[model samples]
Target: DWVNLEAHELNIPKDESTKNEAHWNCTLKNRTVKVLRRWLNERATYDKYQDRDELWLTKKATPYSSKSCNYLLTRLIEEGDVPIPEHKEITWYSIRHGVATHWANHVGPHHAKEQLRHKSVTTTMKYLHSDSEMRSTAVEQIW
Candidate 1:
């Protein structure tokens, strides 16, 4: 698959969101573009690709599944020496949830809802994590 660098966006045919939200537009910045450039070069040289349309492929050149993505993340975390507590858990959905919480905090719940393309704000709220201390500080500052 080819990336349209000039447009500075990645067109995803499908996403984890609802059915109507089929097309997900991922914005690409300069840093991401640089990494993509290197990856594209590697993809071109990789054997067994067989002219596939998929952006990500395995050593066998098949399309990467959600399972593989999760596995890869685990391996990367271990390699990067990121600490994880025994009780804590991490998954692809967790990353998405964290982003949703961040968006809700910085902008507004409605903005996060729109960005996630959820059917309702209630659904978006399920993905967010609250910070009581932050809320307390904000309330104190309001006086």
Candidate 2:
């Protein structure tokens, strides 16, 4: 699940000054919007502020610090008692990397670039690199 909902739940207006509109719009999802609405509704019960601006205090609302977010995630992972994957250690970032890599390999570059909001095709290409062993197998089959 996306982590930024706490800020929205606290009724914090996004800091538009630093917002990368392109990046945001590109990655925005219907699920994220729905979660944000749920958070706002939950918070509204206890919160007295009526206006959107007041509810979402630009400076005072809890900031979504990535480091803290990761720390909390680590704790949750430990608490879940889930088995670790046999092949690799799964981290929060692996999900993003997997999505990017999957898109680049399966969907092609231009579509992947748009989905990822990557500034450069070269950056997107990095994700397209399949494992060397897999590449070798692919080449053998094709040739």
Candidate 3:
């Protein structure tokens, strides 16, 4: 299992209601590992800056404002060569919602809450939608 140890090592405060730092472990496929290693190697080729602040100021690395990130994503969708299905309304936040929902469906509520770093379980639950099929299945399990 490939663990993203970075999140676990983050010295953030945790409360009963919220987890500030979240991590996920996955079985790393060879191709994905190779790709990640390549990216890290490429990044290492550049001279190290004194600190994160200096790097941000001196290099092309700038903080991504939420609005700017969303705008850039939309532009990429519109102009990029990749074929994507037409959607009437789509926003960058939807991707986060989708990931939360998917995790909730596969791993159950408790795990999903931890993974998402949600302040409240209620907020995590909001991502999970109840459909008629799921309701029926849940009812059957109770009997």
Cα-based TM-score, every candidate: 0.76, 0.53, 0.55
User: In terms of TM-score, which candidate is strongest?
Assistant: 1
The runs of at least 3 residues in candidate 1 whose Cα sits more than 4 Å from the true structure, single-residue gaps closed, are: 14-18
Best by lDDT: 1
lDDT of 3 at 88: 46
lDDT of each: 0.78, 0.59, 0.59
Which residue pairs collide in model 3, if any? Answer: none
Model 3 Cα displacement at 121 (Å)?
Answer: 2.1
- The superposed Cα distance between candidate 2 and the true structure at residue 65, in angstroms, equals 1.1
- After TM-score superposition, the amount by which residue 85's alpha carbon in candidate 3 deviates from its true location, in angstroms, is 8.2
Error of 3 at 33 (Å): 5.2
Query: What digit string (tens of lDDT, one per residue) describes model 2 on residues 82-109?
Result: 6767776666666667787777767677
Clashes of 2: 1
List model 1 lDDT by residue over 49-135, tens digit each. Answer: 646767788776677777888888899889999998998877777888988998899898998887776769999999999978779
Query: Could you tell me the lDDT of residue 83 within candidate 1?
Result: 96
lDDT by residue for model 3 (46-80), tens: 65533332212223466555676677778887788
